[model samples]
Target chain A: MLKIEGLRAGYGAAEVLRGVSLSAEPGEITVLMGRNGAGKTTLMKAIMGLVKTSGRIELDGTDLAALPPHQVPRQGVGYVPQGRRLFAELSVAENLEMGLGAGPAQGRAATREEMLELFPRLRERLHQRAGTLSGGEQQMLATARALCLKPKLLLLDEPTEGLQPSMIGAIRQVMVTMRDRGLAVLLVEQRIEAVLELADRVSVIEMGRNAEDFSRAALSGAEGRLRARLGV
Target chain B: MDFGPYLMLAMLEGAVLAAVLALMASGLSLVFGVMRVVNVAHGEFYMLGAVVAWAVTTLLGAGPVLNFVAALIVAPLVVGAMAAAADMVILKRLNYDPERTIVATIGLLYILQQLTLMTYGADARPVVAPFNERIALPWVEWGDKGLSFYFPWGLSTTSYKLFVIAAAVVLIAALKLFMAKTRAGLIMRATQGDREMATAFGVPVERVYALVFGGGAALAALAGVLIVPIQQAHYLMGGDALLLSFIVVIIGGLGSLSGTIVAAILIGLSDGIISVFFTPTLAKMIATLAVALVLVFRPQGLFGGTSR
Candidate 1:
């Protein structure tokens, strides 16, 4: 489980996240929806210690706020940043190896065979440069790489952005599989339908603060109100 | 005097020079490629290597072979430690900003140069070679009865010079293998490819940067140690080494390993051959002119990809 309270973060002289608090539990997907520039990315980044922040970010009761970005992964937090951010020149296998370099959780990481089985297309392009992958394949590779950490809590920032419908479905299945496997997922997404289908709970972010929190079952009747709040 | 023998001798000498240049320039390129920071103080590390070698040899009071062997192992380690400390103390504090690092290294260059001068003095010092046996070189000539091998007078090289070339080749190969096959190298390459992603993956990038800075300094020091026997250790020696390394790096492509080696060979061979046949100044002039033309026409360099 991951918890954050009174999290305030921003770049120099300009605060983007103001007193936001949220929690994500195991075996569930916590979908965070927000309008453009509502600070969804900054929230994820702050949790990963990529940005300076004042807050109590706890993963299984250990503080992550004081740690550096590199140390955050060691706390069982795997981040799939926006844009995939794959090592463009590195091979897919090498990229997976890089994920392992972060010191996998419990000295255990997903093996190449496991990753290949999960994303069969990756096995065929094992030696191909990650940059050369198609948009869909790159997204899959990014998820596979994060999975290599065998992380307790995975943070995904818009994993389906710019993806085709088939690729979106594939990603949806991956998220569902992770959730069922008892992994905690904190996902920042814009796809309301996918969120309704996949998320166990939803939190809407409004202008750097948590606006609402409700069960995914409540989303069906509350779609219009949620859309009005999201301004989507 | 037959010109063929002289040309052959020039080429042998050029190869030796090329070996040393390749080691030095490759280190420079690797550091730039990984850190994206131009190390103006790199030459000072080379100078320190020679100084350390001199001190080690003198303190051990051993035979030429033993002394050289000890110095070879000790000099790079000491310089590498010093560089790592410098990286942590200064470069890291500056956050490795490109312009700030450049300025920091420039300051470090003078500081190191002055420290060496104050401690070691300004005198040029010689380090005796481990072995200096003369090997007569034979050349094949077409005679009345097919081809015959003959040793032309004065056409010979010292065993130590050949050893320097061999050592360089072996060490360079080892470095390449280490970079390609080692886990540390994988982390370094990952960091080079994408710093943010590497950090997110828990690479401890600061440690990698320190290792790389130290490794690059160690390489330059190793080259200095190997060449100190031929070229006396001097306080001002790093100036030319730095200039020549920059030339090779620029010509080969700023961050390319293979490009650095190729450019080093090209420049080193030309420097040696032209110096033998013509003048060293002319060789240098021609090299400078060539670099200018390369910059004007193909600024990315001969082997460089699109500028990083």
Candidate 2:
């Protein structure tokens, strides 16, 4: 489980996340909703310690605010940053190997082997350069790299953004499998139907503040009004 | 001299010189390839290598072979460390601007050159060839034109220049293997190609960048050391070679091994051949002008990727 209290963070001279607070319990797909420039990414960056922040960010009751962005992976928070920023010059195999870092992970290379089963296409393209991959394949590689770490909390920044319908379904299945395995997922996304149907609980973020918290049932009849406000 | 024998001798010497030039040029080009830094200080590194080799050998009372061997180890590590430090303090702050970076490194090059001169006292030192024996071929006749080829048959190549030539070729091949096969090497490739994305993936890019700078410096230094036996290790030894290396790198395409090697061989042979007919200065000028013309037509050098 990941929790934040009054998390305020921003770039120099521009504050994005102003006093935002939220929590996602185990096995919960908590989708944080907002329009463009809604501090969604800022929140994600703050959580990963990529951006400097003031306020408490705790993962399973341990303070994570002081850690570096790279250290967050060790703290069980695997962030798939926006734009699927993969190591372009490296082959797919090298990218996965780098994710493992400083040798094999926890005496088990099994995590990677398992992922190859879930995403067989990656196994086929292991020797191919990562940058040459399609958008969806690159996204899968990025997500799979994080999943390779076996993190407790997965912070996904728009996994479905710019993805084809088939790719979306594949990613959705990946999320479903993660949730079924009791993972805490902090999904920052724009898609209404997919996120609403997939997320166990929803938290709407309007201009850096938590506007609404709802269950899947609360999405009924209010979809149009929410869609209009969000311009989704 | 008969044209046939004269031409054959020129070709052999040119090949040996080409090997050394290729080694020096690869160091310069590889640094640019990985870090995109001009590394104007590269020449300083080469001078330092020769100086270090001379001093270490003298102080240790070692033989020329040991002196050459000592230089092989010391130059890269010392210069590499200095390069790493420079990157951390100077380049780290400089916003990755090509123009600024070039000026900054040119400044660095002078500082290093002056530092060494102050430490070592501006003098040229000679490094002796390791062995005494010269195994000579009795005679090699090419169509009865009387072309005699001589070398130490037991050892690979008796001439230190020829030895460096062999090492240079091997080093390049090894580097290609490292870049293509290794995981960490792949990270460097990515960093060089798309710096922003490499950082996003949590690559220790800054550290890698410094390491590469130092690695290049070290290689240049090695070249200086290798050249010591052929020429003297002077305060300005790196000056001429550095200019030639830059031309070779430009002609080779920055950061490309294949491009650099082919171009170096071409330039080295051209220089030697031209030297037979003209002064060294004119040979250099012609080589530079030749490279300039190549750039005018193919800005990326002979083999550089067209897009760059």
Candidate 3:
């Protein structure tokens, strides 16, 4: 489980996250939805210690906000950053090996074999450079790389952004599978249908602050109001 | 003198010079490649290596072979530790900002140079070679009798010079293997590829940077130790080594290991042969001209990948 309270973060004097509070629990996906520049990505980065912040961010009772970015992964937070940020020059296997360098997870991390089975396409291109992979394949590699950490909480920033419909479906299924396997996921997404289907809890962010929080059960009757609030 | 034997002798001498240059330049390249900081103080590290070697040899006062062996091992370690300390105490504090680190290293260059001048003094000191057996070089000529072999007078090299060449070759091969095969190499390459990604994956990139800086200095120091017997140790010696290293790195393409080696050989051979045939100044002038041409035509140098 992860908890963040009154998280205010930004670059220089321009603050993007203004006293936002949120939490994510195990065996569920917490989806953060907002328009462009709503600070969804900034929130994720704040949790990962990538940006300067004044907040109480705790993962399983450890103060994550006090740690440096490199120490965050060791605290059981696996991040799939915006743009997939794969080690372009490194081979697929090597990228996976780098994921292992994050130190050991609390329980055993996912093995190379399990990762290959989850993304069979990666098995065929183990020696190929990750940059040369197709967009869909690169997305798979990014997600698989994060999974390789066997993280207690996985933070993904737009895993389906710019992905094809088929690839989107594949990623959707992967998220569902992870949720069912008792892994906690904090996802920043734009797709309404995927959010409705996958998100156990939805938090709408507006202008760097949490505007509304609702469970999936509350979504059916308030679809129009939710869409209006999201400006979609 | 028969030109054939003389040419052979020139090439042999060139190989030894090339070997030492390659070691020093490769270290310079590695530091630039990984840290993206131009280490202006690199030459000072080389000078320090020689100084340490001299001090160690003097203190031990052993026979030539034992003294040289001890100095060779001890000098690099000491210089490497010093470099690591500098990285942590100074470079890290500067946050490795490109311009700031450049200025910082310039300050470091002076600090190191002056410190050595004060402690080691300004005198040029020699390190006796482990062995100095003279080997006569033979050449075969097609005389009237056909294929007559003769030992050309004044065409020979010291056994120590040949040993220097062999040692350089072995060390280079080991460096290549270490970069290609080790986990530490993997971490270093990852950091080089993307610093942010390496950190996000828990690589402890600052630590890697320190190690790389130290490693580069160690390499330069090793070259200093090997060549001290041929070229005496002095506080001022680093100036020429620094200039020559920059030339090698620039001509070979900055940050390319193979390029550094190739450029070192090219420049080293020309310097050796030209110095023997004409004047050392002429050889240096030609080299400078060649660099200017490369800069105008191929700014990336001979083997640099991408314009960076």
For model 1, the superposed segments whose C-alpha errors exceed 4 Å read A103-110, B143-145
Please, what are the lDDT tens digits per residue for candidate 1 over residues A148-200?
88889999999999999999999989988998989999999997788778888
TM-score of chain B of each: 0.98, 0.90, 0.98
Ranking by TM-score: 1, 3, 2
lDDT score for candidate 1 against the true structure: 0.89
**A40-143, model 2: which lDDT tens digit per residue?**
98898788776779999999878889765546667676778788877776788777776666223574478779878888889999999898999999989988
Q: What would the per-residue lDDT of candidate 3 be over residues A1-100, giving only the tens digit for each residue? A: 7989999999989999999999999999999988889999999889878789998999999989998778999887888988998988789988888887
DockQ order, best first, reads 1, 3, 2
Q: State the lDDT of candidate 1 residue by residue for B131-204, as single tens digits.
A: 99999999999989999989999899999999988998898888888877788878888888888788888888
What tens digits encode model 3's per-residue C-alpha lDDT throughout B195-234?
8878888888889999999999999999999999999899
RMSD for each of the candidates:
1.8, 3.8, 2.3
Shift in Å, residue B125, candidate 2: 1.3
Q: What local lDDT score does residue B225 receive in model 2, on the 0 to 100 scale? A: 76
Q: List each model's interface RMSD.
A: 1.1, 3.2, 1.0
